[model samples]
Target chain A: MKTINKFKMQLCAKSTNESFARASVGAFIAQLDPTIEEISDIKTAVSEAVTNCIVHAYKEQNGDIYITVKIFENNKVKIIIRDKGCGIVDIKKAMEPLYTTGGSERAGLGFAVMESFTDKLRVISKVGKGTTVTLFKEIKSK
Target chain B: MECKLNMTDDTLTAELDGEIDHHTAKNVREQIDLEIDTQTPKTLILDFSDITFMDSSGIGLIMGRYKKIKSIGGKVKIKNPSPNTYRVLKLAGMDRLAKIEREE
Candidate 1:
């Protein structure tokens, strides 16, 4: 697929930045003219990935989160969120629904929601190194 | 984010405001739980009429609240979520645990 446009940003992996990540990407992707529903889905997926960086990836230390938004052909969009915090030791188990290690207040549903909202989802991680999450969604023409 | 709570006749209605994410969910959770712990209302109603956005953290917030009230034999009802928020809640299967009223 041919690439159309793209942008990248980095911010502190703080819980307060969750909304910032979602809103920034939402505003940028507004160029694609996504419907309200499609934009909402994109924002929700972005929120989950960014929140994971704050709660799990950077759990032990302060770090930075990098976000890349790219618009590809066929009205498809891809979002990548990366963090240099403690990586997941078990990618398969971690992706399972309701499998959270952050005590009870945390619902292990982060990955589940991201997977459900996006057309495609990918996660890559290495323990003692870092983690990256990618989300893909298609927008309908108005 | 803010949650305005009103209680009468053993029913506590919590009207939520603003966006709900990991950062804001914490404060909302504390406010609602404090009321539930002190008032011990028989029913807890989460009003999403004023909410503009939400994510999975909001799911955790509702689930934790549900567990808190259920242990005391109380019930939870979610009111007036926008269509998009309703979609997120349904993805988490929240509809199975509580009574959710979708906006018409």
Candidate 2:
């Protein structure tokens, strides 16, 4: 019992692309009648996830990020953000509070905030391979 | 972005316009820190009246400021955050740390 909708977009590993990815996902999912607050939360979570990739993965340089958005009929939205760049070596430690690898002003709260925004969050990574973050939200329609 | 910094006898006010996400948070935090360090105000007021959007990075920025001022025995206050931004701030537990005033 499932109806699925999927969207794929390729973006550069730049800060601006974070907003572009977030806005596109928000506008597309708004067709399902989510509230402004709900949409904003989704966008914020997505932006944080994507920005982590741009900053940590590509080190604020040029690279490609693949974002996939899926909509389920059970009032659920899932976002998968994948990057083919430097990956996290310690997933558990990275998810800890304030454990940042880079010294560039990152508080390491990106994953924490993303976890707080959605119902389910998962990260899969391998060193020198890539990283994929999947976020799930059970929509509370407004 | 246009950042307006105002200084009173004992208070420092910073009005940030535009979005404050990961891209801009570092710069904004640095600028505010420099001003606060130089002025050494007793109280810091952050006016987010014109900010359209923010993310978790903004929360980190605020937290860092809170820590900075707390060490100096000063207080930090936030004003006029948009409803959307307010929701994010609340989610991040900001209302518990600072006095959030809703005014135009």
Candidate 3:
């Protein structure tokens, strides 16, 4: 795949940074001329991944979130969100909707939403080290 | 994020404005819960007309509120969610918990 454009950012793993991550990614993805719905899907996917870093990865403590966005041939966009925090015990179980470990304010639909909104979703984890989520989507805009 | 709340006919309507994300949800939850606890209304309406962005965190917000309102014998109504937001709500099966109205 030929890379057209790419950028990387490192942000604090905090709830406040979630919107910043979404907006920054949304802006970068805009160059592909994605439809409103397409952009929303990407933004939502980014938010979910970043929020996971804050809530589950760092546990609201303090860490760094790394995001890399890539634009490839055929208007395909790829995003990687990573954190060096507590990884999931069971990827399959954590991906289940409403099976949250983040307590009352979480619905455990992060991975599900990413799967539904994007063309491909991938998760990699090591229990004591970190987790990385990659999201891919092709923009077919009007 | 900002929420405008009103109570009429025992219905407490919260007009949620701005993006609903993990960063802002905590404050929004506190505001709505405070009103729900005080008024104890028969209905809790969440107006999303002004919400510009939402993620799964929005689902968590709604689900938590639904449980809170349901325990008090009240119901929840989600109003004017953008099509994108509605898709998320439907994906999570939230329509079964709250009555969602489109563009009213």
Q: Per-prediction count of colliding residue pairs?
A: 0, 0, 0
Candidates' RMSD to native: 1.0, 2.4, 0.9
lDDT of 3 by residue, A1-142 (tens): 9999998999999788899999999999999888899999999999999999999989999999999999999898999999999998999999987889999889899999999999999999999899999999999857
Which model, 1 or 2, shows the larger DockQ?
Answer: 1
What lDDT tens digits, residue by residue, belong to model 1 across residues B1-104? 98899999999999999998899999989999999999999999999999999998989999999999999999999999998899889988999999998766
Residues A1-142 of candidate 1: C-alpha lDDT, one tens digit per residue: 8889999999998888889999999999999898999899999999989989988988835899999999999889999999988999999999999999887888889999899888999999999888999999988899
Ranking by DockQ: 3, 1, 2
Between prediction 2 and prediction 3, which has the larger lDDT? 3
Whole-model Cα lDDT of every candidate shown, in order = 0.92, 0.85, 0.93
Tell me each candidate's TM-score: 0.98, 0.88, 0.98
DockQ of each: 0.85, 0.48, 0.91
lDDT of 1 at A102: 81
